[model samples]
Target: MKNTLKISLKAGEKIYVNGAVIRVDRKISLEFLNDVQFLLQQHVLQPEDARTPLRQLYFIVQVMLMGQAGEGMEKTRQLFRDTLANLLSTFRNERIRAELKHIDTLVGQGKVYEALKAIRALYPIEEQIFNKDSLQEEQVFAKAVGE
Candidate 1:
C-alpha cells in the first residue's frame, strides 16, 4: 500500500467504493489499508449540472469511476479520451489547457478523485470564459443597434 486513507462520514452519507455504494447509518470513520477508488456523495455531479465543456468532461470521467460505464471500461475510457481531445482544441486559455493536461495524467494513472478535484477547480475559470463571451456578444449587438 502506498498510504492509508482515512475518511469520516456522517449518518446517511453515501460513498461509492470500488463500484459499491455504501451508506453509513451513524457517524463513522473508515481507514483504508490499501488504495481504493471511492467517491463521496458531495463530489458526485448531477447530469444536469454538466452544462459546460469541462463539466461534461468531468461527468464522463465520473462515469468511469462510479461504475456506471454502460458498455465497458474500455469504451468509456475511449469516450474520455475523445472528449478531452475536443476540449483541448476548443479552449485557448493557457491555464485551463495546462490543468486539463494534468487532469488527463491523473485519469491515466487511475486517480479519478484527484482528476475530479482538478476539474472542479477549473469551474470558476470556465464560468468566467463563458460570461466574458456572453458580454462580448451583447456589446456587439449594442454597437450594431447604435449604428
Candidate 2:
C-alpha cells in the first residue's frame, strides 16, 4: 500500500509534480495517495544559480524533473553518471565520497530527488574544504615571504 503524502503550501508556493509546475495563489493543502514525483519550489535551482559543479549537476537533473525526460533522458542520465564519476574521483572527504555511492544508487533507481538532496547536503563540506585549502595557501605564502 502506498503511504499518503500531505503537503501544505502557502500562497504563491509552487510544486513540481510529475514534470508539471503548479502554483497556488492561496493557502492550500494537498494529499497524494499514490506514487507521485514532486519537488518543492524552495529546492528549485535556477540555471544561473548553478555556478558550482555540483549545483550545475543539480540544475541538469532539475531539467529532467522539469519535463525534459522525453527526448533527452538518456543524455541526462549519462551526464549525471559522468559528473558523479568525476566527483568520486577527486572528492577527498570520506563522508562525501561515501555518499556518492548512495547518490548513484538513488539516481539509478530514478530517485533523482533523493540524489539531489544527498548532493545538496555535501555543499557545506565542499565549501569548508575549499576554504581550508585557501587558508593553507595563504599561510604558506606568508611563511615564504617571512623567510
Candidate 3:
C-alpha cells in the first residue's frame, strides 16, 4: 500500500507526495506546514503507535554513531535539530511545563545524566528565556557529586 503525504516548502510552495515529491502551483499555507511539522516532531500523528518518525530519527542517529557514515547523515542531524527548535519555539508554554516536570522527576530520582540531557536539549531555545549561569552551576555541582 502507498501512502500520500503533503508538505509545504518555504516561500508558499506545496509539495505532494505519493512517496514521491510533486510540485503544486497553488500557494501553501504556512500555518498548515507548521502544524504538520510540529505534529511530526512531537510524535502525535499516531499517539497509540509504538513506532514513530521521531523515534526512527533517534535510532538513525544511534546507528550512524555506531559505524560507517551514511549519505545525508549531516542533513538528517540538521533536520532533527531544526525541527526540534521549531517545535520549542511554537510550543514554548507546553514545552517549558513539560521540561519543569521532567526536571523535578530527574532531581527526585538523582538522575543527573538524564537531567543534563534534558537541559542540553532545551539549552538552544531556553538560553534566552532562562538563567544560564544558575543552570550551569547546578549541572556542575551535580557532576562534582558523581552524578
Highest-scoring model, lDDT? 1
lDDT per residue for candidate 2 within 10-109, as digits (tens), equals 9999999989999999999999998777899999998879887678778877776666755597788788878888988988789988988888888778
Which of 2 and 3 is ahead in lDDT?
2
Shift of residue 133 alpha carbon in model 1, Å = 0.6
- True-vs-predicted CA distance for residue 134, candidate 3, Å: 38
Candidate 1 lDDT tens digits, 1-147: 388899999999999998899999999999999878999999988999989999899999888898765568889899899999999999999999999999999999989989999999999999999999999999999999999
Minimal lDDT window, size 10, model 3: 35-44
Candidate 2 ranges beyond 4 A from true positions: none
Cα TM-score per model: 0.93, 0.91, 0.25
Which consecutive 10 residues in model 1 have the weakest lDDT in total? 65-74
Model 2 worst lDDT window (10 residues)? 62-71
What ranges in model 1 sit over 4 Å off?
68-71
Candidate 3 lDDT by residue in tens digits, 22-42: 344564543332212121222
**Alpha-carbon lDDT, every model:** 0.93, 0.85, 0.43
Between candidates 2 and 3, the one scoring higher on TM-score is 2
User: Under the 3 Å rule for N, CA and C atoms, how many clashes does model 2 have?
Assistant: 0
What lDDT score goes with residue 54 in model 1? Answer: 91
